[model samples]
Target chain A: MLRPPYEIVLKPYGKALVELARERTDIICLSGDLTRQTETDLFRDALPDRFINVGMAEANMIGIAGGLARAGHTVFVNTFGVFCTRRCYDQVAMAIAYPNLDVKIVGFMPGLSSPGGPSHQAIDDVALMRALPNMTVVDLADAVEISQAVRAVVERRGPVYLRLKRGEIPVVSEASRRFSLHEAQVAKKGREACIVASGMMVPAALVAADVLDANGVSTCVINSPVIKPLDAATIVAAARGARAVVTAENHSVIGGLGSAVAEALAEAGVGVPLRRIGVADVFAESGSREYLFDRYNLGVQNIVDAAWITIAPTKPVPAAPAMPLTAGTYAPV
Target chain B: MQKRARLNGKSPGGCGDGRLRAGAPAPVRVGDLARLATRIRLHAVHMVGIQGFGYLGQALSAAEIFAALYGGGLMRPGWDRFCLSPAHYAVVHYAAAAEVGLLHPEALKSYGRDGTELEAISTERTPLLDLTCGSLAQVISGAIGFALASRYAKDDRRVFALLSDGEMEEGQTWEAAMFAAHHALDRLAVVIDANNSQVDGQVNSVTTLEPLADKWRAFGWRALEVDGHDADALVASMQSTASERKPLVVIGRTQILGGLKSVPATADGHFLKLDPALKAAVIAELEARLA
Candidate 1:
């Protein structure tokens, strides 16, 4: 099997972002002292006036971006996924997402991109962002995809959370393929089963599909780059045609790509046996990135096993729908 | 039951008979500003009364400051351009915005009603509000970001943020203050409604932010102190912008329970009961003084 190319890395995306910023003066970038890690240093060096370093102030960084968005500047804030998601949830919700501000939140080193441990891992970022009403969540599979996603978000106006891995992963999409914020891409076509994946897991799912094919299990791999809005039609079609579905992600299985696919299938009234392979609801201990992936059962083998189990489905059970809340009973405020 | 006369379109310092025109100019005056402040308080009381209870202590205490800012024309309203940080004193903002004709006066009546947008905390979802600020220290930094954008764009417009004294205790507030000072956001003006009260008690007793002016100055801000209730002092402090460096922080001292005899001036200002009689008495006293 031929290995995917890794020549294009994360830095080029930051460079492309800076190049785009030069053309669009409304673009502003902010970093929480992680420019080097996020590769936004390229943009910072190119456009010094447009880049701001809040220096370990993640909360302030989010707030500042919100304010900048209000003043008609399309602000892009970059930081580690953990800090951007968990540390500054309030700022993101109240200042940016609630207003539906045109602030792009770029979360670098997402989902075990860093080997530092669970502290740096962004397992629940999707869940956190999905809870907000007006937030668009995206997970970039490779460096090439990051540039396209960033450009798409800049051109489109709204609050977006882009999860980016630090280093270069295998490029799943070709240069000719254009990406939209809410559309899903089918990486490979097969009839037996479909594997819906996002972010770093897309490459793994592709590899797993190849493995399953050699074992006489024809598999389809769908790269769901846009996690929010769930690309319902593509997902429903994939689920309907395939005998079963395997959803994979580097994020937590609770509210990441797997959960999003599951919700979409349920909402579309398409009943198919689905299996999720991702981080369980627990903080990971200190380990190397490879070791953590193996320990969490998120590797290609895990995807193959989950896919096999889902395809051998038996019977369906129907449950009663939950009653709607009465006026006095519902209190979100 | 004696019906109170409406004072719409009437000049400042007018009689209740609606006949005697005080002959004041259509232009906003300092005394007229004070009257506007009194009217804001009246509306605030009425809104809270409809809700049965609310954060009226904080709202009433900050009315004069809101009046001074709006009446002075320092803040640009009626145009959907400026942003307001309505953290704890959102009722005062709603009342003042309605009085200034920025929002419909009928909207004021919808305070705390079911499905109404006028929430207890200011929300960014509302078109009139630029950012939601219920979580205390969040809005300060949001304002600083706005100020930075203004500076970047060279727009020359100022971003005004009204922060609570208790909100200063939030670490994010200090973070924003330090950033503002470091950035030298001259276009940003922060007004600390230093009512000396919080949900618990007095700010000093609850969490001491002693030498508050020194703290802000140390954080690289040009800090000033003023009587929060005194419109002239608040207006003067707000008008005087430092040309040298640092963002401006006008720490306006206010009474916890201003103009309310029933509610004692204490730190537990979150929940205060003012029955119909007490409300009537306060409004009558205010009416007589203004009359």
Candidate 2:
């Protein structure tokens, strides 16, 4: 079993952001009635003028943030991942992304963070945001990492889409641990295989690495907090050194962390057997977080199994590239 | 000039072109405004010719109105920054900006070129523009924000936004209209190019904004309708607008595909193919009008 850091957990990320907001008066928080769920209510209670409740209008909320950003305010717009991605995609691309405004979109309840059903689950946010040219996509592994990522986004003046998981997530870093945006962090080191994971899957990969160590298979666990701008050098070195790679994420296997890793390997001309363990292309049904995790094969056992398969001598054939998408063709209104 | 055209025995079109004489001296010369409008049209035609396709039809239709605003001194020409909502009139906007000395004429020629800062839609990179506009109805809300900020700073700088009739289909436009109205954004003036046509067909066939004036009134805006091509009428209405407690919307009715017969009015004006002869004719007509 792997141990989680206790100093700074996931829930405090929102609280820490509020504390930071006190010093930076320009930071305004807007929520689509998900303040309690995303832990942004902690900030809202403290700064009423700086906090705006846009009701349930995710699309309008994003527009308002973009407007505020244009007026030189560092605005943070928060909502569930599903609504933030699919519901208000046009606002993200046109208002926030295209304009390159200083708006940080915090998508809470990413992947199966909620047991509310398919509607609440956000499995394709990374894929959706990464498609845009100028957008910075981030998936924080734990609460401590979340705070660091939030501060980094504030300092970096551009549009950022942050995918955050809800409720109590295991801590993946210390409060004092500093990391740069768009850089990958090494959680565990080994030579036999490398386990690359993002967001919620980082903790699972750590557990799987411990399990692999007991089984006499050494593994290196890398936490990729930033999804877009993939941190090519770090990922490439990890791929070049390891015999095989296992990628994990709490998102769709199609366009999340796994797909990003594969693209990096192919671009660098480094050939290694890779296994992607994530939710397949299907909507998650209503169930507890544990049920969904087990159902989608996103647990420690699955990661270990995938890692073992990747390192096996008999390598599987490489998958073909998916069909190309033309501009303005993805999702139509 | 006070020709009373009434509906239901009441002056429905309320105070026609006669209101111009009563206004405190007009901001711009009528002939000069007309010349500026012709130049805007000529520039739009050439810009579209360079692209091989563009929203020339709507651009030409909106030229006179844009000219009136830019040339009349009602809006600070080189100093006032604009937030354009309906993005199809890129060529017209750039040309007007150049004529007013806000941007260099050379920069206008560089539009749509590889790595050019002048994009089809208004972007903040232009410096003269405050917000990027392409997706419909977004600029209205953005303008509201800018207007509110100006109010906070106690600045008299106004936010001028130009919207399209077709964009009225977007619900956010109405939301912004209501928001601006409730806040009494008198320093903000929105000009709607109501050419009566949009992509697909006539706006009535797609989404009708009949009683458009009533809609603005319901949203608590002081609405005024004007002949879009008549620069003098537009200048008068703009000058007489209340500047303290209420928002204003100038619904300048225009002829769709104006000055060009081949350009289909019913089609979406974003992309259009112009024949060489028609292009020359447009250029000649604009030059002659300006001369």
Candidate 3:
């Protein structure tokens, strides 16, 4: 029996969470009154005793989750994107992140995956969580990564802010190594240009790679599961011979994965001309995910457009601050 | 900035010779705590003198309460956790730490200077401090987390939160208050110094936080009231036990500038450059009380 290539079912992610909760009694699910929307209600229903509905209070939920985590429970915090990042910034920063507790903030509806407009969407969550110290951030690229993400964060110590996606999503990186939190996978390797992406944009980058491959201009696609503590070595290696680099993500291009990739390249002294293909620094209107993606130039077409511009024939550039880019001595660029 | 936001009390008209009042002695019923409170008040006065300004009035008001917590057996240097919110009250905490010998006696000299750990508000960099708080009302939740953690580890230790009347204006306080009660965190005790003073003027004038006792009670807490300046009552009430199903809170009612002996009768002392004569007088009065 061949499993469908694209699974549109949102049940798997919630079901995975419930399964994890069932196996570990210490895993407590805390909801900011968004259980149904975030799909944490599965855990709430499965483990009623361990679930807490904190009632539309993001900060209090974080603080409560912090206490619960301190009490020896693996707490999973769920809420809308905006509320988790902006509304509860202080509690998340001070109570959870500052103490370096073992709490997981599972923020649902990453980027434009909502029709509820800017208020409900969390387009900058990745950037916000990445800025904080001790915060491990991961935005899922596929539905299959859901269970893997659940296990990865539970096994790791310290606080984590995971951007989760529900609804039907394709499995772009099927054979990727079981989802290591800090490892980036080279899904396709041709080296015309390296297209770095994480979360929802992983699929788009893959499609873009396909488009570039058909044009006789090979493109390398790297799926970065963990945005923070990013796989620096793999990124530099992936961009070793590529003409230029292009970054794609389902987030604002300002400070999300695109910025991160750029920083890694600059430090590695790649000096590869780069184009960040994601949402520009602007407030997107309320619409479906597909509409926003096309409108914001984050569609497969946009990735291909960026790839052509990056890998187009051009003059050679000087290497950035020629230091031996090795682990032992990470010198400044 | 949230700093200097606490609605302060007016400068009291009477800077009476509050030095134990001779025959009308101070509340000495709590053993050596009176001297400890006096020492804390004196050190704070010195700090005020050094900076020529500070949260002098709030420190003076809550001296005995700090004595009751830090001086008594309810809280100690390394055994239990004490969270001082609003962070501006570091002088009082440092004084209490010095009294208990957790801090070096000479370390109090760099109270508000740069490059020193002695920040205007208490932070984790300070030795023997557990919670770092400068932003208001957030420490209560952190304290709640600490208490919850202690219980989770099955440790016998308790967590105490020292807040101000002004912090009640923060919504997180109420959320944490209700959360502590809902979780039945018996190992936590929150004490609010109802000094009726803040940065703007009177706290009531800034925002009505009256009926505070009933508010806590409604949130499913074991609420109690006591004379914040009476070390005996404050210590006695804090020592009272609570079942594992409920949390405890004590409202220590106190006068903002009542612990000191002298001031420019017109100076509220909330945050002021102390007059040279008044500085000498405050130190002398606290010295006489200690004597």
Candidate 4:
């Protein structure tokens, strides 16, 4: 269900983890000194014994997480998206990924959500993680998925990299909706164009689908939270009927959701015209999310333009309106 | 760069707790450790000879250290965890492990062959080690993790990591050093094969770490420097952790070739290249030492 004026859910990830830790004695948490920003502060304060502050050394933290997992504990390592992935990629690869340890790498402030510019953006994290063998990569959509994914990812056997957005997360799905790692949620159904979106771009995708439907272009939107082992069946089935496909993500189009979708479609032999909506292989500047999104062509209008242009290549598509970023609301049109 | 007298100034007998576990036997005698070291040298020479070439210099230099730990009972079988931080030291580790019956002696012949568990450089798939050192200076942190886990589980089993002198140049080594000391991982011990040799050249010629023991002590650890080939001193310095609450690092100083006379000066010991004649001569010398 596509909900308007999405309500804010605070610390959903932290609360869910603390609740889960109450029952799972083998659950351990590690932070590279971004406990509050990455939403592991609640775990630190509640389960002090199980929480470890590795003090900004991402490499050492990852190595310690591997060791802890070797000793029969599920470790949740938290830090900013960039610091956790790019800064210590070798350690993560050799220590955690190679051994296929049970470590959940929680990276916060996915993509341009951070006002900290290129240095803080994890634009290539998905690509790096996806290339490693036995790594499960995911980008959660909203508060519901973030909370549900905490338990879902722990049940998994090997290493997992879960990308998240920090601070007041939006409630995009119904409160009763169940989250599953194996299924990609179909938010809206139509036949003219298919929109595949992940992470922060899911809301923009939803608004674009509604506007496209109002303009008499039937659009179907699928929210794909798990990026690596993608739900290809539902996406290929939807693309099979649609005349065009537009993939959206809050990451670089080179190796993120767009690339994943492109591979899936190509493998399935669904030759529908495709347009990828993402950061066009460039480092973004520090700014508010609204400014960065529009500048990087991640706004609702970009998806609409991509969706419109691909469906009717012979006709010049009219420029769509900018997304209305209202106060106290998430992705309002 | 130049050799200095032992820094701690504690005699081998004065150092070490020397507490034997109840119903636990004493360590292997010094003469037996010597024989075990001789067997290790013979096996390493044979294995490297079969592979055409390998890190035979490293195996020769650290043969006694490996013998003391694996065969002399310094490292308890199935109790303590051992981390091989220098991946190239797999030559010595495999020979030592095989000498102790952990691995079949015949497996040494497959060294450096395709699809064999004994890779020239150790990896995660390498058997008998708690954690393998794929890249230099990274495995110590994993050893610290194992030590931390032992503490959390209230298990007294200690953790040991073997490093090389070249690893001192890596910043991650210092990062791990600070972390282990800050946490006061007393149950963790590291034995560095300060053999003064690396691929680029000698360690000091590349990057001087002359005040090595001081650097470790400054980082909140008890540092000990001793003759690496003396198994008695190595075991004594290693077992001095019963009362200490800080981590211990034994800097076992060694030679590049452990004074092997057959190889000419032109032969670089870093990655030793042995022709058939030189290989046969080395094997005969090591075999005579074993006999």
Candidate 5:
């Protein structure tokens, strides 16, 4: 049977926000003149009165969101992920987190999703947000997850840092499924190895699991939307069932999903051999999404190789092969 | 409403219409506001004296401006929103808020102390302080947002914010200014304490904001300049609608360190904790001033 060509489906990050504003009058959308980039234009068009275009002022946008949030308004401050995290970290930490204001920061183009070079990449956003106290960090896997993620953040009090992927994103999960902040969704169940992933990495991890399954490696894929208040119980349970565990994320290995998973495994006294497939500690150059992924060892093959290495039927699987040095650009699997 | 009209009809004030502008308020009590300003300064000095550590100089310089807003009836304490943007000058804001009965006087003891609601910086934990001032030039955005909300809710209550002249160096301040003006947030009023002092040195000496009033006007705001210490004129300007149809920015010209008899005026009073002898002398001076 001939299958239809693969298509990139546009996600509803802005649509969901517009709908939220329709339901809740207090929901306001603020953009730093990146209305089209962050896709908050949908909200802006639906509720022009509630939308605020703060020009190129990212810090002011956050401060304004802080004020709106303090006044009992659900403020959604939008910009690129880099600007949201690195450009104005102090505002996000103190203005939004310290006082625990109800402000949701939506930063689109997480990780290598943007082709605007290293400056636009928000690879360290999750790591930076996770370090802040009283912050809820969530990275969506697809459109279906965003539907749930947006509602969860809006309903819950306190500040939230939501990573968004703009433009046409491939849908991996069912649209009917509900998204829980603290709960980890087991995309697929297996026993040989547990593959934990987040945001856009979930689809990649699922594909890697399939490849691993075809090669006789039964992999369990866990989709963790909440990165900061991580679903430790689920991760620990899944990791315990498998002799080895692997983590995949669309961010730098340091202080992100990989680091969180490592900390969780160590704290829970789960001594499973672990492998992390993500961007190495190096400045990512300008390239297409696929080019950046393969260049930074975040491709499906990297995940497959990492899972196979970790799934070795031995105590503490040797991590030498998994830690492949970046010899040259796009090292073929 | 009838009583206020009758009062304005009798008072020879710039604010004869009961609006907070350069016109004198209907019930002009300049002497009482002046006394309140002195009390706020004394409270600030006393707070700095507690630990022999605080932003005493800027606190003293901004005392009258705070008084004009809180004590003078332009800002109805709890009713009006005062965002203290320059977090270092929290002593000034805390004293003014306490003086107007918005915060309990005892809260002064915990100024700069750990576990106290009163943080060294102007945080939301403090009463009547709506914004948690994190960095410089950012609080104006909060005031703008508050104004937007007030209009959205169809409330006439104005949003007030105090910022330092040194913070003009931050690009976000102008960003907020442009936003407020573009939105025509007439309900939002900002007071720039142009004390000409920062951590580096004189604000203009560091980076000149020459023709600052022109700059504000260029950004679509009704800008004005006034002696920060003149409580009456300052209150009148605040009450009047002279700067209507847009946001207002009052360039409050003030001394970096003013009205301190005991505490030696430093080149920069961004933060100061006087020596023991100086601290004692300052406390004595405040007591005599209060008496």
Candidate 6:
């Protein structure tokens, strides 16, 4: 599912939400004045009556979302990942999460995907959301997952923090493959090493698996969309037999996919050599996704090298060349 | 101003779900509401005195506002929603709810106990408060949501949010004020208990928020200033919402422990520590007022 000539879907999340709202009258969409940028403009245009532009007040927007949810409407709060999570975390925790309201906080531009630097990048959103009780944290890997996830979260009760990448989203998976909130999809299976990754890093992890396979290191890749309520069984099973386990994410290695997988492995008693590929604990600078990912050591080669290090400790793994990216080209599985 | 005048002429009909207790007298006039306010204070004294220390000042200051809201029947139990923005004021809310029959009087005994619904600072588990996050200045935003949702459902039920003067210090309160006015949520009303009291001393000393009504007016709301201790004024001001297109903000000027004179002026109203002697004096003072 992860290869070049990758089909790009424009505003799949916004369109999917609009379609969902057409049938579900209980759905209400609120935006913190980033409607067009967050793709909530589609929902605003389609369902003008149900759409509320709450200006730039993120805290009030979250509170209003909570109130709407309390009034028996499932609310979709849309804004940048940074604004929705870190900016209004208290409101999200108190107003929405504490009561376990049915408010879907849609945070666009996850991790280093935003060139808007530290203020705009939501590098620690998963950690923040995961810390809150009754908060379902989801980081969709592709357009297919995003489209399916919008409906999947609404079906389940309680609050959800869904992180999405804005603009042209890559469709890594088929429409037939359903998105599950409780499960992880094993994209590739191998015997020697396993690469557990989520969101933007999933594609890179897939490409890294291919590179490892070619280098005579058979690697398995697991695509985890749900960061919280992690499919630990699938991860632990894959790690149980593998010689090396590598977890990758588009977030800091501190409290996201890497930490979650590490916790799962430790609790499950699956003692395997593991490597994490992500942003080292530091505030990121403004740059393109490609520049930031590579600069932060989150490229495909980084994942391949990390996987190799787990298996061969003392020897320095051979430096692999960076993968070339073209228009509509996302690293594939 | 004319709308305010017109509302003052006729007493609000207790048309909402009868909020008074089963045996309690129905509040029919200004005097009835005033007496109800005193009863609310007495109930609060009982609850807070049981805990030795609690947010007694909030109850004392917001007594009349709650009486007009709950006892005077401004809020319907199942129909309308009430948001207690200041979580610490849960003591006052629980007392008022007990005073009205929304909660049993015996249930007030469990106030602030571990594993009890009546938390010292209200959480989601707290009874009676429709939306409370155990944080100050945040619940008003949720009240705006309720008002917006009610508008969508075509339900004419109103939402009343009780806020502390200190909450104005928070930026989110003004954000919610701006949103409510922009949307013209007429059914939503906010009662600011400008009790001039907070944990860090007087609200004015900490954050100089003078000309509070003007601030709300600037933010596009129909601002009404009234003696917060005057239950008639609160009921009248809240009832005047029928003609208003914009959201209403009733700035009720009040004093901590205003209705009671037993506590010294220098005493902190935020959290009152009732020694056995002070507790007896407070109860005696409130009991005489109730009589």
Clashes of each: 1, 2, 8, 0, 16, 3
Over all chains combined, what TM-score does candidate 1 have? 0.88
Give model 5's share of reference contacts.
Answer: 0.42
Q: Please, what are the lDDT tens digits per residue for candidate 5 over residues A279-307? A: 78777989877678878888677787777
The 10-residue segment with the lowest total lDDT in model 3 chain A: A315-324
TM-score of each: 0.88, 0.83, 0.84, 0.94, 0.88, 0.94
lDDT of every predicted structure (CA atoms): 0.74, 0.74, 0.75, 0.83, 0.77, 0.83
True contacts reproduced, candidate 1: 0.49
Candidate 6 clashing pairs?
A2-A332, A2-A333, A3-A332
Instruction: Write out the backbone clash pairs for model 4.
Output: none
lDDT of 2 by residue, B1-291 (tens): 111111000111111122122323323333588778878777778877886677777777888788877787676432233567877677777887777666677777777777887776555454355554678888787777667655544556677788889889888888678777766889888888898777787788887797998899888999999999888788788777564588989999997666555454444554667668767867776677656
In candidate 1, what are the lDDT values of residues B1-291, reduced to their tens digit? Answer: 111232111221111122223332232334577778788888887888875678788777888888877676676432112345545577887887777766688788888677887766666434355454777788888778767765775555566778788877878888888888888888788887887777777789888897999999899889999888888788888779656877888888888677566555542566556678767776786677579
lDDT of 6 by residue, A1-333 (tens): 656557787898999999999999989998988999888889998889999899999999998888777767788999999999899888888877877788899999998999999998888999999999989999975999998999999998889999998898888887688899999998999889999999988888887888788778888999999989899999999989889999999998989999999999999999898888888999999999888888988888889888887886676665554556677756531
lDDT of 4 by residue, B1-291 (tens): 111111110221110121122322333333588778878988888899885788999998999899878865677654567888889999998898787777788888888899987898988767767776657888888888888777877767678889999988987888889999999999899999999898988899898898999999999999999999988788889887556689999999998787677777557777988779998988888778766
Worst 10 residues of 2 chain A by lDDT: A324-333
Question: After superposition, which runs of candidate 4 have C-alpha atoms over 4 Å from their true positions?
Answer: A313-323, B1-31
Docking tier of model 4: it is: acceptable
Ranking by DockQ: 6, 5, 1, 4, 3, 2
| Model 3 agreement with the true structure over A128-221: per-residue lDDT tens digits | 9999998998988476677678888888888898887755545544545478887888878877788898887776677677767877778888
Candidate 3's C-alpha lDDT?
0.75
Task: Report, in order, each candidate's fnat.
Answer: 0.49, 0.22, 0.27, 0.39, 0.42, 0.60
Scored by lDDT, model 5 comes in at: 0.77
Which of 1 and 5 is the better model by lDDT? 5
Please give the distance, in angstroms, between residue A200's alpha carbon in candidate 2 and its true position after superposition: 1.3
Chain B, per-candidate TM-score: 0.84, 0.83, 0.86, 0.88, 0.85, 0.88
